[model samples]
Target: MKPGALALVTGANRGIGLETARQLAQRGAVVLLGSRDAVRGEAAARSLDPDGARILPVALDVTDTRSVAALAKRLERDHGRLDVLVNNAGVFVGATAADTTAEVTRDILAVNVVGAVAVMHAMLPLLRRSSAPRVVNVSSTTASFGLTSSGADLAGDASVRLAYTASKAALNMLTVQYDRAFRQDPDLAHIKINSASPGWTATGMNGFRAPRTVREGARAVVTLATLPDEGPSGGFFDEHGQLVW
Candidate 1:
């Protein structure tokens, strides 16, 4: 992206989020590492940059409206604008569709779907201030209806967790709708919005079962986050290429 661009990444205490933040910082962006816990967030930021040169940790519990608002306010007061937002914070509770309870589904949606949207909503004003802004929603292949229906590995696995799968599907739609809205608004047309699937990375969310490393999984996210002004929006993509919704 632009030199010294401001970027915020959620769930940055570990896994793909952490890697994404690291990559962004390496590319010269001032990165904000957001975590639900302040202590963990600060530690993660320190681990990435002991001198606190480029990365800053911020306490952000996406499920709480007040916490999201507080983060937005802090960003505005400190930095004035946000150039990139990586909506990577998510939760997974493994249970088959048949065994998944309403409560479990609700909990998953609270983080994976509602929490993502809430953060985006609160950060839009700050994003608009940037000459080129981007919002990358970290999604999954399981979220793709085409892949799931076509029996694509874990995405079509009969034992996949319904709550997690459904929440990601919702997140994909959220990305599409937000992108469309921004594109139609002349004043905000410069904003780029896209959903990215990290391709089954070995993150804590999956109990470290996936084959891909966090660095590999974070590639698509960083690509979308740092997309040029001419890049596509309202699209779903993976490491290989674009995906069907």
Candidate 2:
């Protein structure tokens, strides 16, 4: 909540990301709206906090390296440090197992998995500068192997998607890897690294057939982003509580 405690959220132009930005700004944190389109990002920021100086827009396309680096440099010059990072930029092409192709899976992973890591790699330096840094990767229940293994495809009545689920599964592993990578440093150890399943949230993605709203989805992400000094890392959670890997 400090003046310099900035939080960057990718794909923040709408859906859960936008709601998360709004909530963060409401809590006195400077929210950086990282959207692929500059104009849209600016619009989202303004909508979140019109008169407040806490909302700013950063043009970022998670899948593009040039945009990622540019955003990192921009943030380094402006804030020098970042308190929270929400890698919320992702896509879901309805590719079911029966009809899903390798190309479709690759494309989905490119954005949902690789894109998230690229963003993290770009902003890690800034995050390290913070006293209480946090990383929250917005994931889904479909990513849960246990859930999927049990054939609990929550998308039952909705459009069944394979590429999307696989991408999130890869993302969960990425989250765990990041957590393990920084486990040695005591200072960095306090930096909570976790993934969360926002349930079936109604967002711009998934055609909005999801039962939950973006506001509800934003809760778990925001909570993980602003964890206390003593908080769990290398875990997946939801609005209800901890979820099995």
Candidate 3:
């Protein structure tokens, strides 16, 4: 058996997701890089972990059901179960993207919201078999009600992209609902599920203009992914600590 747990991270070909995968692998987990492009996935996996500590490249397009199911089956056969799942894939309909048509909105939601749910559904059984199962959602601070409220801090910030924010807000609720469901069931309550904000980082999503390095932004995700069995669930946190929902 491996000395540490096993983990899978979606959208790990670059940016925060790749950095998080790297950090998790460094911590001893057998990390799988889930990417849409097989070549990019394998390349990223190698770049982050040249010596290969248990890291593998799994060709995964979260929006594709068959691919998701196939990855689940492969993991079941290879690892028996998955210990961690990081829902890090997201789409940011930027400032100019506000003019996006309903079709565009649906497309974004398909990958960011529906696709994530599908992956979660597919991975649940494998996770159930693990003693310490964890689902860490890579969310954004813009999803915070506290931040978006009119009188609260960061209100009126033009950086808030409507379509993207709404998608993530819905995702946060999804996290809460899943946590409640897990808690209600004795067999699954042991699973820790939480949403985390990676903060503003220089990634392709933001055009790599943000100040924080990918390493700095990936910390909260790595922390939540490797949480102790007793760690909090259904909470939202940033790098410093928990955030006000």
**Which candidate wins on TM-score?**
1
lDDT, candidate 1, 60-92, per-residue tens: 999999999999999999989999999999998
Clashes of each: 0, 0, 0
Candidate 3 stretches greater than 4 Å from native? 95-98, 151-160
Better of 2 and 3 by lDDT: 3
Badly placed stretches (over 4 Å) of model 1 are 155-158
Task: Give RMSD (Å) of candidate 2 vs. truth.
Answer: 1.7
Candidate 3 lDDT over 110-211, as tens digits, reads 888898899999999999998889899888888888867844554224454777877888889999999999999987888999999888888898778788
Best by lDDT: 1
TM-score of each: 0.97, 0.94, 0.94
- Candidate RMSDs in Å, in order, are 1.2, 1.7, 2.1
Which residue pairs clash within candidate 3?
none
lDDT of 1: 0.92
